[model samples]
Structures are given as structure tokens and as C-alpha cells.
Target: MHVLETERLIVRQLRIEDAEFILELLNEPGFIQNIGDRGVRTVADAEQYILNGPVASYQQNGFGLWMVALKESGEPIGMGGLIKRDILEDVDIGYAFLHRFWGKGYAYEAALAVLHYGRDVIGLKRIVAITAPENPGSIRVLEKIGLRFVKMINLPGYDEESRFFEVDF
Candidate 1:
């Protein structure tokens, strides 16, 4: 399902057909360094991740990480949307783009759109975001989207602390 649109991007549901793109995005050095490796070493694994992660989330939770694509070419550039982590109290806005798409404002535009969807359509009251403490770029984006830094979080499986931020609707 197509969810939202920005001036330059289209945010939509992820499909099994997106495995190729997911494989590349998940293995990018920046994604591994900042978001951690998803261990998707093969295309099959990527398909499974799409099924179990985003597709399943959409079916069961009504929202998940959406594929962000260029409106002009319909080329997917990243993934972003509402994530319901078992460890978090509120839905978190999560996103990651291809390395080539960095520093281009797509993250901000996609995220800002998702946040609005979370509030206006999903009826969410509190939305949070987490990023590695050293990721200044992500921190800047989160802050730019109006989520205030709340604290450092050591989630159940993380080896290091993640900076947590939140915005209350």
C-alpha cells in the first residue's frame, strides 16, 4: 500500500520484489555501522526479512518500515516508517536510506511525513526514535523532525547505548 508522499519521494509498502534493494541497503557499511548488520547475506534471506519484518508488521500491526522511492522514476532509495518494537513503550519512527542518498534531505522529508501519518492517521500519541550515540547525522535528523532527546537506552539486545528521542502528540 502506498502510504505517503513528499515533494520528491513516495513511501509505500515493501514487497518480496524489494529483496534486491533490501539486500543492498542492509549490507551498506553505513547501515551496519549505525543500524547494525541484519545478517542478510543472501537474496533468500532478504526475502524472508521482508516477509517477517515489514510485510508481517504491516499485516499484524497496520504499519511497518515503508519503502521510500523517487517519485520521478519509482526507484526505491530507502525504508522508513513506524516500528513497534517489543522493548519500546511507544511506536518508534525508523528509517535508513542508501548511502548514495545521504545528505539529500530525503530522510528528513520521509520521516517528517511518517510522523504526521503516525499522529493524524494512526492516532499515536507518543512517537520515539533511537540512534547510535555517535551518529550525529541521524541525531540531527531526529532533532530536526521535532523529537527531543530524552535519554540513552540500552535495549535488551544492544551492546551499546542508543540515544532515544521522543515527541508527544
Candidate 2:
């Protein structure tokens, strides 16, 4: 089902059929460098990741990471949506696009829409995001979407700290 739409992008739920796209996206160089290796090597692994990650989150939390597709071509360019993490106090927003699709303002556009949906539809009071300290691009997108840098956070299982940002409604 479609979750949200912007002027140029259509955000929707991830289906098992999207495993191929998920596999490709998960292994993209940009995704691995910024989001860490998720160890998804095969289509089956990608399917499992979808079932256990986004699909399950949607069923349990009513929201999770959704697919970011282009409105013109219906091509899956990335994944962006709200994530409810046990490690964080508030729901957070997470988004990533294929390297080829970067620098096109899609990330910021979809992020801005997700913020509005999270605030107006989901009625969330707070949303947060975390990125690697060296990822200037992600930081820029986060800041552009209205999340201000709060501090560096080291979640329980993560070894390295992340530059955390947050925005309150």
C-alpha cells in the first residue's frame, strides 16, 4: 500500500516482491558505506530482511521503512520512512537512496513529506535521526529536513557513536 507521496516521489510499503530491489539497494556501495553491511548476500537473504525488518515492523508498529519510488517511472530509487526503534525513546526517520539517484533533491523532498506525515497523520511528537560522523551528505539532508544536531549517541549494541539529530512537533 502507498504510504505517502511528494511532488516527484511515491513512498509505499515494501512487499516480498521487492526483494530484488532490496537486494540491490542493500548492497549498493553508498548504502554499505553509510549504513553498514547488513550481510544480505542473496535474494533469499534480502527476502528475509524484508520479512523480518520492514514488513514485521509495519505489522507490529503500524509504520516502518517504506520504498521510495519515482513518480514518473515508478522505479524504486530508495527506502525512506519512519522507524520505531527500541533503542530510542521517540520514533525516528530513516532514508537512503541509490548512489545514482543522489544529488537530485529526492532525499530532502521525501524526508520533508515523511516529517509532515509523521506529525500530522501519525501524530508523533518527536522524531530523531542518526548518521555517521563523516557522512556530510546525510547530515546535510537531516539538517535540511529540520532535524538539528543534538549530540553523538552510542546505542547499546553499536560500537561507534553516531551524530544524532532530532525535531519536535
Candidate 3:
């Protein structure tokens, strides 16, 4: 189902059929370096990831990372939406796009829409985000979408610290 829409993109739930794209995306060198490897080396693994991660989140939290696609072509270019992590105090927005689709303003557009949805639709009062210290692109997008840098902190199960950003409605 469509979760949010922009002039050029559509955000929606993930399904098992998206395994091929998930497999390719999870293995992208940039994705692994910035977003951490998801161990989705095969389409089957990607399917499980969708089922156990995003799909499960949808059922449990009413939202999760949804697929971001071009409205015109319906091609899955990325994924973006609200995430409720166990370790975080509040919901956070997350997104990742195939490197080929970077520099097109899609991240900012999709993120802004998701932020609004989290606040207006989901009734969330605050949204947070985290990125690797070296991920300037993500940092730029977070700042552009109105999240301010809060601090650098390490979360459990992660080796390195992440730059945290936040916004309140």
C-alpha cells in the first residue's frame, strides 16, 4: 500500500517480490560501508529480511522502512520511512537509495514527506536519525529535513559511534 507520495516518487510497503532489488541494494559497497551489511547475499535472504524486518515492523509498530520508488516508472530506487529501534528513545527516520539514484534530490524529498507523515499521520512528537560519522550525504539530508545534530554516541550491538540528529514537532 502507498504510504506517502511526492511529485516524482512513491513510498510503500515492502513485499517478498522485492527480494531481487533488496539483494542488490543490501550488497552495495556504499550501503555496507554506510548502513552496515545486512547479510542479505541472496534473494532468499532478502526475502527473509523483508519478512522479519520491515514487514514485521509494519505489523508491530504500524510502520517501518518502506520502498521508495519512482512514480513514473514504479522502479524501486530506494527505501525510506519511520523506524522504531529498540535502543532509541523515540522513532527515527531512515533511508537508503541505490548509489545511481543519489544527487537527484530524492532523499530529501522522500525524507521530508516521511517526517511529516510521522508527525501528522502517525502522531509522533519527535523523530531522530543516526548516520556514520563519515556519511556526509546522509548528514546533509538529515539537516535539510530539519533534524539538528544532537551528539555522537555508540549504540549497543554496534562497534563505532553514530552521529545522532533529532527534530521535535
Scored by CA lDDT, what does every candidate get?
0.95, 0.93, 0.95
Cα lDDT tens digits, model 2, 15-103, are 99999999999999888888889999999999999999999999998999999999999999999999998899889899989889999
What tens digits encode model 3's per-residue C-alpha lDDT throughout 1-169?
A: 8898999999999999999999988999989999898899888899999999999999999999999999999999999999999999999999999999999999999999999999999999999999998999999999999999999999998889999999999
After superposition on all CA atoms, what RMSD does each candidate show versus the true structure? 0.6, 0.8, 0.6
Alpha-carbon shift of residue 120 in model 3 (angstroms)? 0.5
Error of 2 at 108 (Å): 0.4
TM per candidate comes to: 0.99, 0.98, 0.99
Query: Candidate 1's residue-wise lDDT over 38-64, tens digit each?
Result: 999999999999999999999999999
Q: Which residues of candidate 2, in runs, are more than 4 Å off?
A: none
Deviation in Å, model 3, residue 11 alpha carbon? 0.4
**What lDDT score goes with residue 155 in model 3?**
95
